[model samples]
Target: MKLVVEVKLLPTPLQAEALEATLCACNTAASWVSGVAFDRRTYRNFSLREHTYAEVKTRWGLGAQAAQHVIKKTCDAYATLRANLTAGRLGGPGSKRHRLASGKPIEFRAAAAQPYDDRMLSWQLDARTVSIWTTRGRLKGLAYTGGREQLATLARYRRGESDLVHRDGAWFLLATCEVPEAQPNSKPVDFLGVDLGVVNIATTSDGHVMAGRRLNRSRARDHELRAKLQRKGTKSARRRAQRRRRKEARRTRDINHKIAKHIVAEAERTGRGIGLENLTGIRERVRLRKPQRAMVHGWAFAQLGVFIAYKARRAGVPVVYVDPAYTSCTCSRCGYVDKANRVSQARFVCRSCGFVDHADRNGSRNVRARAQAFWRSGAPSTAPAALTGLDADGTPQPAVCRNASASRQ
Candidate 1:
């Protein structure tokens, strides 16, 4: 229910520098703490325990609230690393795991000081701002301490909203606030089935399809630029390549976010739960060429699902992930399964009952069916599907349909 709102901070040049320094210090302290935990776990039979706000304040010379903020951020990073390691998603110890840059030394940034009240923390807006505060100088920018107006704005946060993050480059005040839950007086009767695919993005059980737009044009453009840069082998070209990489990443993320938001909105409007494919082990099961593998990996399927779930939760709707087995091959009409059921990448023609449907549509139907089954069994909202399409060997059955479909009408 908590939502984070980020607003730009206006501070002088000196303040910015000071803020950056403070952040660096905090990051360094956090890294040292994490290293200590890692060492303890390695040499001593001890588990990691996150340092509390008070502990950090006392040890690191930070204010109580400021220490808490740094601790939270550090714990979040640690959790990311831990998950990656457990999932085998991280490359070996020397490789980049999640966001931690491998081989780069961990450093801290600006420091945070907790306010007298538990609600806020104070940090230098910038180096210039820091200088001003230290020397009692003045600057031309809006000056307002954390107060009632800020608190009011913080209360508007809704689920699925982007978090307000404070970066070293800029100063901002951000807080995660909660939105009221909506209550529909009437009971819900309808449901929407959503199937996520590599090629098509999403297909609803109701026959609504959101085709994946080929970002290949953008990819191709980037490739040409990269190749030219590689041939030039100049420092400027390398810099340009880095900028291009960042831009492309931003564009791709924007597209995915838009698609996810649209899908969630549609489901919410219909007052129905969204049924989706449980894609837990999808990446491991599919075989692809090198280029294709990279593309698929970069699709951020997990983020899309997460967006749908959080958005649905906020809207008082539900999201259900069903087993992804046989979603593509099983006939939505008669539940017939066969390898030959899929006529092509985009088409599904059931061999057993001659049922013809879109490949994604069939998958969506299967997803809905699985959701209904779960609901009937009184499974928890967070429970995974009971029966996946994979057999004993972890190979998916060709024609075994897994997801259920709602009538398009």
Candidate 2:
């Protein structure tokens, strides 16, 4: 399993400047290569490599590794763009469908950090410092600070490439490390279901809730503050707003990490697989009012899912993503499905079975049921039936038992 650990770095101003300069040079080189690739519709490394090294090193004062990394990144970007285009993922106005990009090379707006491979970087555990290459040459004694556990973890594994980032006013090293997988579980009894939402963040079938009201409130405050600062139209206000946004993002990320850790640990301790909603493209699927859309779209449901999955994998807890259809409206007690079953955002009253429970909790139970059905079928997960299906004339069909088709996986 691969994980990234952010280690605070202590670097001289000159060293920081050098790193930033190298990143800028990398971005410049990539832009040139990407422009060429886009024009020729060539993304292979060999084709892209033909433009590298000699001219790049002279043009950007980049070392051998830095130049190669830039060319590689440009090729990768074009490859990704091609793949997405092939999948029909990229389209609409202003998107490149046929014509090449403008003559001006589309440069990376942000400084593209130079990646270090084993050939260009080394870490010393005793000194807590890393030797990384820069445009000027190799820069040694770049100190890193992190918890003892993090330091030990980094020392244990073969460290992958680490990106040097300049955020706000601090210089930090984002270190990637590979850790061994946990022992396999002999038997798993049941599954723990997690329902994610903007209100509570996560609600598990075991009756545990990680409330998100406070987080939501904080996010609202950030939004208000940003709008207010922007209206002021002052340089200082802009800078202050930027700092606040960064702080809010860091705080929210920390909370998510904690929540993911707790949920995964619970599943591991109880020897149960985890059931999570398969919410891919949920934002596009669900319609919301303007006010509600902002809140729902701002929440990081996908990031939380990723965090939960990776942590569960490291803890030997199997995870299953169930069809999210009818998970919220279906009654876990009687398997009744109806939009009216959800009386409110937080309350659920089943007209079919008279079952009453928290809406998210009910959804979590339904998620668990679907996961169990999927496990029994022993096949890839598929989307659950829609909560309210449409008839031949496009009228909403009354909710009824639709698990028969679902059972076939």
Candidate 3:
């Protein structure tokens, strides 16, 4: 599979300045293009895609490549905003009309110059040194294998992934790679169910819970600090608040990454497929106060899921997303549905069957059942089973059962 490898570019001071200047020029060009589009949409009957790299270069007095870079950056931003609007993820048209009319500057992030040649973007290496160059400047860094290894390590991207830009400071590169299509030769063996919740980030069908302890604590502290900072209303306090906000975000992301990695690794160790809840529209369903809302606004559950999916694919495992419908409320044993079934935050007692189990475990059992159903229907059943459970001291638990189903084989 194709992958992207990103190495930090180390340029000389002069080169850095030149690169910065090029980025500034590109930003200016993008602003101008946005202004043109705005004016046309405001007054004219039609808007045109008449802004070309060559034309921008000539009009803006920037070098040919640099001007083109700027225009591309601007177009990228427009595309991002457009996408958000189309996806109903951002404000609609005229929502930012006041800002536009006030001549407030439209901001754009720095753009990297594209490689001029198409031959896998040539790189030279000597000893421990590596370097590549674009029209703007040379990118000097460590060299990695030019193929999958390099791509995967540097870019964390696979082959065929598309590139998309966002308003955030981070850059995204997506790649899709091909693997031999999965062909199950035996009946289905076992299924591991996954349930994601606010308290416990994930509960597995095997009765294991990856609790969201760090996230909860981090969020709580962040809220407390934010309150104190707002009360102070000092410049230093505001700066400290921003620092704390960033730290909390980083901590949350780190925790999520670790949890996802552990989950995928465990699943790969077993020879069973994974079943997960399809949590679409979950964010909208969860109601919270403003402070809590802000803390959870970008929790990245989707990103975490994506990470798990891709990792599973690489390990030749399958991930199935089942409808979440009543996984939480329905009793896994008797399929009873009642609000009173969940007596507390951590307990699930079925009224019909009198089945008692950890709430997360019950959800996971339902997830596994759903996954097994999908597998029996001749759907793609590729994810491996998780490693066995844990001992009383939390050590690795041995596999207790292994039975291939009629469909899995």
Pick the lDDT winner.
2
Q: Which tens-of-lDDT digit does each residue in 305-398 have in candidate 1?
A: 6556545655777666777888788888898888789899988998887888889888888888878777667675552322332234422222
Clashes of each: 39, 0, 32
Alpha carbon deviation, residue 16, candidate 3 (Å): 3.4
TM-score of each: 0.69, 0.85, 0.71
Question: All candidates' lDDT scores?
Answer: 0.56, 0.74, 0.57
Reference-based lDDT, residue 89, model 3: 60
Q: Give the TM-score comparing model 1 with the true structure, all chains together.
A: 0.69
Worst lDDT run of 10 residues, candidate 3, spans 400-409
Candidate 3 TM-score to native: 0.71
Per-residue C-alpha lDDT of model 2 across residues 1-409, encoded as one tens digit per residue = 6566667788888888877877777787788777877677667887767856578888878777778877877766665456555655556435665334332344664554456677777888798888888887788998889877677777786455766666666766666666666875535788899998889999999989999999999999999999899999899999999999878877777787788899999999999988888787787788999888778878877657666766776788877887789888999999989999999999999999899999999999998888888777787542222311223342322111111100000
The order of the candidates by lDDT, greatest first, is 2, 3, 1
- The deviation in Å at residue 337 for candidate 2 is 2.2
| Local accuracy of candidate 3 as per-residue lDDT tens digits, 349-403 | 9999999999988989998999889878877533222211112332221111111
Q: Model 1: C-alpha RMSD to truth?
A: 9.8
Worst 10 residues of 2 by lDDT: 400-409
lDDT score for candidate 1 against the true structure:
0.56
CA lDDT, candidate 1, residue 242: 79
